[model samples]
Every structure is written in structure tokens, then in C-alpha cells.
Target: TPVLLPLSAAVNTYAVPANVLAAPFVPFITVPGTFAAVISTTLPWLAVPILWCCGLAAACLGLIGRAAAGFPQATAPWPEGWVGWGLVVLYVFAALVLAWGLVDRFRYWHMVLLAGAAAAMLALVLPVTALAPSRGLDHWRVALCDVGQGDMLVIRTQESAGVVVDAGEDPLLADQCLEKLGLDTVEALVLTHEHSDHYGGTAGVIEDRAPGTVLHAGSADWDVDAEVESVAELPASVPVYRPQAGEVFEFTRELRVRLTVWVAEAHHAEANDNSLVALFEIADPQLPVGQIGAVSHPLRLLAMGDMEEAATASLLRRDGVPPGVHLLKVAHHGAANGGTELLEATRPAAALIGVGQDNSYGHPSAEIIRTLEAVGASVYRTDLHGTVAFSLGPNGLEAMELR
Candidate 1:
């Protein structure tokens, strides 16, 4: 019984939900992460073979006992074969489990660990993976569809997959954008930074559509009743991938966008500058991953995550904006930060600023506009037009202003 107790505990441990441990293995298949693969690659010498050996041993013991019990020379049935059966079942399960750790490898494992992984992953990933894309055969496109004051972005792809970045100032505008894009439930919805303009009409959008995922900046003011612990809880079969700084959760290797957590204070939303800056590598049109040495479009996209001059300046230091192409999302509705040196370094061909019409802030201050213009960057303002969008085309950028 002494030996059996430890063995029983070990076997039971294998069934515990693995969500706590699964983060290390992210981006395994559809989702692009490598902590697990790294461990699997580096730690190849030990566990796999041991579990395999144990499984083989357990099966052999079970077979041997079964064979011996049926022999004519046997006097009574073997009582201990039940133990052999248990071990056999367990080891087989362990070996089979790693293959289908999550939906990425969708095979059945012990019911015990599955539940645990779900609960633990839910608790951990709920907030972090909020904006993270789901993993699947799902190919989607999300447009924060450039609804100027009112945020209205649309997410959709060739597949049935869809998500909305934000519903612009107008509820009718959002519906129009949805209709133009031929979309229903965003499948996933994200409010990058909260200002009434960003979140105001969003509730109207969510009221009708049932999305598979919803992630926001946690910025204040938006009343999110449907928000939950994990994207898994979003009445959808989707697997959401949220991340912290330096954590590379892939939107796609080329299009991958990592969230850099840059908040010193909590509760007070940074609003416009608090925008989620995503480094979407605009890969070379001609080169493949193998041939491409460095991203040609090395420009960092400052989604702002509502990061003001203070936040942007700090992030600039942390990320180190190189002397590359500048694609700036002007901070604080283009409120004056006066970071002239930073603008020169960014060397943006163009810039986009979102400010309200007749707003109180007097945003896009001339000082800031001149600063961006001084560096040879053309500016796009939401207040002047409506929704703004830039697509990476074959040659360069397909820039447009959506009204």
C-alpha cells in the first residue's frame, strides 16, 4: 500500500488540468508561440522515453498477468492485475495527452486534466489574451474600420471568421461598415482604448451580434456586460491568445502583434495614447520567411493603447524605435507632446490622428501637427474625414480615408 499510494498520487497528478502548464507551449500549431516547443525541443532526453517505458512496462505486466491467469497450471486468478490495468491506462493516457494538449491538437485525453487546463487557462488568459486572436482554421480580418470619433472597426476574413476593432462614433455608421464588409458577429470584438467615442456606440453593435471573442483595453467607461474570464467563455469555440510585453502571440508570423504592457498607474485610462501598439511586420513582398533576414517594414505601429507623450516616450525607450519607416498613431488626439527628436527618428511617411469635432481638448494642436509635418510626414485626421485605414499593398501602402 505504501508504494501504491505514491503511484496513485502520481497518476492522479497527470489528470489534473494542465492549463497552468500549457502557457509555455503556446503558438504550437495555429497560434504562433514557442515556449512549449522550446522546452519540448531542449528537454527531449528525459520524460518522453520514461513515460513510454512505463507505459510499455504496464502493458507487459497486464498482458503477462492475463496470460498466466488463463494458463491451465494456474490455481487462482491474479488479484494484482487490476493494478497493472490501472498503470497501463494511465501511462497510455500521459503519452497520448501531449499530442492534443489543447484545441490545437484536438484528441481526447483524460477528462480530469482537460477540465483543469480549461479552468486554469481561463483564469490566467482571460485578461491577458483579451485582444489575442483565436486559434483555428479561422482566417479573419478586423478593421477598427476607421470610424473617426466613434470607433467602428470590422473584423472578417475569407473564412466565416470576423471581429470588430471598434464601432466608430455613429451606431448607424457601424451598421453601415458591417453591411459594407458583409459581416454579422465580429466573432471577436476589441476596444483598443476607451473614450466614449470609442466605446459609446459599441454596446449597440454588441447587442445584436454574438461574437466568439471580446477583448478591450480595460479602459474605463464602456459597459461590457458580456465580458468574461476567457475568450473560451464567450459562447464560442474560439481559442483567444492574449499576451504581455515581449510575449509574441502571433496574429500571423508576419502580421504578428505583441502587446507591450506599459502602464504605471491603474484605474485611470490613458485613453487615446493608451492605444495598443502592435508591431505588425510588413514582410517583404518577394522574400519568404527563410530568406528574409530582417523585416523590411521595420516600422513599429503605435496603436497608442492611449499612451500619451509620457507613455510613448517611455515605450520608445523600452522598444527602441530605430531609424526606420514611421507609421505613427499620434497620441492624445494629436495633443502636443513636442517630442520632435522622436518624430525625426520615426521618419513616418504618413500619420493618422483621431480627434473629435468641436471637442474641448483642442486636439491635434498646431504645434504637434507641425512637429509631425516638419519630419516630412503627411497627416491623416479622423475629425477631418471619418474612418482611416492603411493596408500593406504589394508595392507600398494602400492608404484611404473612410467617411
Candidate 2:
């Protein structure tokens, strides 16, 4: 009832000639000198050519009715040159090797040897694809880590670690950023928390660096602890400290950091509404704390970990925010909750938002940008620009936005 397929019909498979196929992969193929081609090519040079030859031989032999596992077809009839003869000799050598195994005194060994070779090939492939070096950390200081569509930042001092905040939806990229900081450690991993975006990489940082501690609003989550332990190393201990209402944690007593829990119930309905807002006093280590006539010390980084209107209201209601904080990691990444009134209350010189590009949850809204500018804050976004870094010293906050 059905018409039979024609045996003589070509499959219409067009094979690439050897020279054309090898051209792109092997740059040295164009070199005039034969020795140059041999020397310039590395081990990778053998992969494409060998696989190409193997597949061509397998396909052609497989398609033939009785030529399964047959030898590869020769290129063409022999030319006058020795090159053609050399290829023929190589083909003959291969044929002889195949014949010896097939018609051997110990015939069973051939199949066993073939099976052993296949097993070895499989063993090599699995490990290569699956395993990566999970041991020693890699040095990649100043990396533009891919924290998904947003940003998470890290800066390493010789003795301490400084993290700006999180981008979102990634712990891996954040860990890689710390890994690039050249030390397998983090002294401090700060959280502006409760939102998945602000603290998304917390577990990654803790698991990878096992940092000394984390500073947060005291309402931070511990849910990802189990998940992080499953994939990465966990901390020996990471305590979250509630920075005092107006007290300072002195890198030095005069050059200090003061934290305030600013929780305004109506403005920030979420837990992010209860962030720990900070006012930092900076001084150039070089300039003896007195020289600049209270130069306000030097570098001041005011960090408000994802504070919404509720937290912002608390700060606004409180007193004693000096002239301003020098380097400010923006609240809720410049969200509407971070109203213009909040920016005026803190009066930061520069602003940084740990945000990502094309994130599912729209962040760093236009309203937030307007608020920051109204306070004369220079805006730096991690998602669009990359990792942003700042150095605090007598000169003030020297910022670098890494692309």
C-alpha cells in the first residue's frame, strides 16, 4: 500500500570540506610554513579536527548497508607530491591495526579493549562538566559582578571588609565580588534588610566568607541559613548587632558611626520600614583629628539599610544629624518611601543604590531619584553603572564606579 523509498537517492547532506571547516578554528592553517602551523596550534587545535573526522567516518560507514565501522574515505587519488603518499601510508597503518585486532590469535580482547576505552571516555566527560574548584578563593578585586538585574557591592580593606548592600536575586555574583577582594574573608557584611533585594546575597556572603558579623536593623531574616548551608559554607557565628540610637562604633572614637532605628509605621508598611539608619563621622587618618577644625573628620558613609517612610520618619523626628553624611547608600534604593523629607534630614553628599537592571520588581523609581537630587545627592546606581566603591580619608569620599 506504501511506496518504497529510493535506495539511490542522495540524502542531500552537504559536508564541509576539510580546509573550509578547519579554517576558522585553526588560525595557523593560513601560515605559509608547515612548522609554524604545528608550533602555533595548541592542544585545543586537535579537538575540532579530530571530532570532525570521527563524525564523518561514523556517518558514512553507518549509512552503507554493510560498511558499518568501516575506515574513513581517502581525500582523492594520489598527486605527484609526497604529501598524498604520506596520507595513504597513514590510512594503510590504521587499516592494518584494525585488521590485526579483528583477526588476532586472542580475538576476545578487541571487544573488551573497545568497551574499556568507551568507559574511560565517559569517566573523563562527567567530571569535566560537573566539578569546579570549590576550594581556595579567587582574587578578582573590583569585579563588575553579575547580581542578576541589580547590584550587590563589596570593598575590602586590609583588615576589614565593607559591603554597601545587595542588588537582588543572586548570592553567587555577590560571593564572586568578595572573592575578588583577594581575601577568603569578610569582616563585616552589613544588611539594609528584610527585602529580598537588599539581603538577597546575605547567605552567599556569610557562607562564602564566614564574616565576623553582620550589622542590621535587628529584624533581619534567618530563613536562608538552611538554603545557604546546602550549597555553600556557613558562618561559624554571625551576630546581628542593633547599632545604638545615637551611639557610634568607632573605627576610632572621634571617627565614628552612629545608627538610628527609624521605624515610621504608616510610611513603610513592610519590615523594610524598620531599617537601621546611620550617621557617620569621618576623619583623614593622615590629618590628626584636630587639624581641619572638625573637618567632620574625613570620610563619612551614611548607610540606611532599605529604610521605608516609617524608618525615615523616625530619623526625621530625631535630632543631631550634623551638616550631612558624606557617602550615602540610599534607602530602599531610592524608593518613594525615601521621601524628600528623609533626604533633607540626612543631607548626604553622595548617594549609592544597590540596584539591578530590568529587575522583576521595579526599583529606584523616578520619585526616589527626584528626592535624592532635591537633597543635592549625587546618584550612583549599581545596575546601570556596575560596582561602586568609595575611599574615606582626610580628603573626603573618593568614589569610583566600576564598569
Candidate 3:
């Protein structure tokens, strides 16, 4: 268990307890399930009752697992890499030596030492309030949700309203992220492309939420009309717009945020190259009385949906990269095909890559990381930091990673 702690990204605190509770049901499920599977070909009718019993037992096990997972501090984050492994090894060795000494000595002080050791272990697994991202984040403007192997970004427009980009692959994860942000209304839902990873979670965003508008790439290859009609949750009253290049969409006057479509035409053969690229300009709020004269330039974010190298180069030649981009949603999840020329042209202060952990495709390539770092751009990946949020601080843009 000590060795596994450092190797894993997180440790399930209640796994042992959950397993113990589910022990009795294990045989009822596995034994019957195996029997049902073996006899199904020749004696299918006889296997019906056995299969039903197995299903019931499986459901009980699932309930036990879910209950355990719902507890606070049910999972605790563990540091990744060689350092964590080394630390765990040293701690385990020390613990073993201490235990041996306490048992041999048998002194009254040994009881106090044992209790202190147990308390220390508990502290390691319990939740720390200071590290929680929900407590103090009133000025957060941009949030990149960690939806594994997909993209989802939320730009705050009002107290309870925001603009959503890319719905991600999983509805539950997307909905959870929106709930965390306290968003009641989606001012605009932008589906950058037709890919499932980008638009599969549309139901999560539009379900029970007041969406003012839906913007998407109306490509002939994929019928946006049929897709939108299929989503029963989307109201008939809401308008869907297919924005063209050079078109600018502005929010309410009070909220100084505007989105400008830079690339939307299907110039390339690849669907990814035909992605809708946009620039978000959010005006900086007035600084507090004490912090006058601080640089308050509007936050400029360039979101390149999934354009590959050829398309990115074409866009660079056509429109050129926007100046002083504060944050960049790195193109194509930081794949190598997401050219470096754009990075050099934009030179954003920070780069965000939305990708899954241990993905087989080897996304967010090392070459891409090097290019961003070379240009002095601080790179943050969803695979590493989980959900990353940026807010305008007194000095400049500040980043907070919610793991």
C-alpha cells in the first residue's frame, strides 16, 4: 500500500473499507456470473435465475463503492514522479523501525508515540481547506475544465452567466464543472467543431440551463441542424448561428467581453483544419483604490479549436496572430501538428492544453512544450493540473490549478 501510494495519482481512502463491506457479495456475483456464462450456450433457460442473482449482487457492490466514494476525503491526491516514491520508501522504513522499537521496549510512552503516528497518517489522507479552490475565487474570469481527452472552457460574463466552448466527451464531468463555477445561464454555447470530444456533452451544458445562443461550424459533412434537433433538451426558441470569419459577437454593454471569429471557413480537406477559431477580449475590471496605476489591459485569449499545422500556417498568413494574447488555448491539445509559428507570433503569457492523462495518442508532445517554454510561456496541461483557472491579479494574470 505504501509503495502504491506514490505510484498512483490519488489514493482512495475508503477503498479498504469498501472492499471489506463488499467481500460477501463478491462470490455471489462472480460464481453465479461464471456459471451463467458457462451454461448459457446449451442451457440458456436454466441460467436465467443465476444471471439475475449475479446482477443483484453486482448492483449491491456498486452501491457500496458509490457510497464509499461520496465521503469527504475519500480520495487524496499524491505527488507524482520519483521524488514521491523516494519519500514514501523512507517513511515506510522509519515506520517499520519505530514499530519494532515500540514493541520491544513496551514502555508507557510507546502508546503516546503510536497514537501520534496514527494521527499523522490521518492528516495525510484528510482534506485540507486551504488547498480547496472553491473557497476564495471571486475574480476568476476564465476556467478550463479538466474533461479527460476533450476540451471545455468557460468565460465568465456576469455573476451567474458565462460563455461555454466545447462541451467535452462526458456529460457528467462537464455538468460538474459548470456546477462548480455556479453558472445558472449560458450566455453563449460555442461548439468549435463537429468532433464528438468537442460537442458530445452538449446536453450537459443546455440541460435545465438558459442558453441565449448556440454557435457552431455549419459544415456540410456534419449536419448541425439534425444534431441540434436531436437534442430534445435544447429549446426551439433559442437561435443557432454559424459565424463567419471577421464577425464579432459582443455581450451586454455592462460586461465588456467580445468574441471575434478569425477562422471559420472550410478551406482545408481535414475537418480539424476547418475548426472555428476565435479571439476573446475581456476588459479588465477597475482596480481597488490602493492599486492604482497597475497595468489594466483587457485580457486577450485566442482559442484555436483543433487546427493542424497546415491550417494554422494558412491562418497566420491570412489574418496574422493577435497581439498581446494574455492566455492561449493551445491548438490540437498541444499535438506536434499544432505549429510553433503561431506560438512565436502570439507569444502568449500562458498556454493551456486540455488533454487526458496517459492518453495513448501521446498528446501535448514534448516538442510543443519546448516551443512554448522557449517563448517564455508558462504551460499548464489538464492532464497534469486538472481544471485550471486564470484571473486578473494586481500584477497580471494569475493561474490556479484545481486537481
Instruction: Tell me the lDDT of model 3 at 191.
Output: 88
Candidate 2 similarity to native, TM-score: 0.52
Best by TM-score: 3
Higher-scoring candidate on TM-score, 2 or 3:
3
Residue-level lDDT tens digits of model 1 in 12-57: 2221233334333332331322333355567766545544554554
lDDT of 2 at 357: 72
Counting clashing residue pairs in each candidate, in order, gives 44, 18, 0
The TM-scores, one per candidate, come to 0.48, 0.52, 0.65
lDDT, candidate 2, 1-403, per-residue tens: 0011122111111223433444443433333234434644575465556555545544543454222212232111122235324433443444455567777743666656555555553454346323422111121112234465544555433333443344355777776655544446565555554556556666667655666666655353434344334444555566645454554444432323233333312234476665555554444343465433144444555666666665556565665454545666677666676666656776777777766677666778888787778888887786776655554423444444433
Model 3 CA lDDT for position 397: 78
Worst 10 residues of 2 by lDDT: 1-10
Ranking by TM-score: 3, 2, 1
Model 1: ten consecutive residues of lowest lDDT: 133-142
Give lDDT tens digits, candidate 3, residues 267-308.
567888878888998874455443311225567889999988
lDDT values, one for every candidate = 0.48, 0.50, 0.79
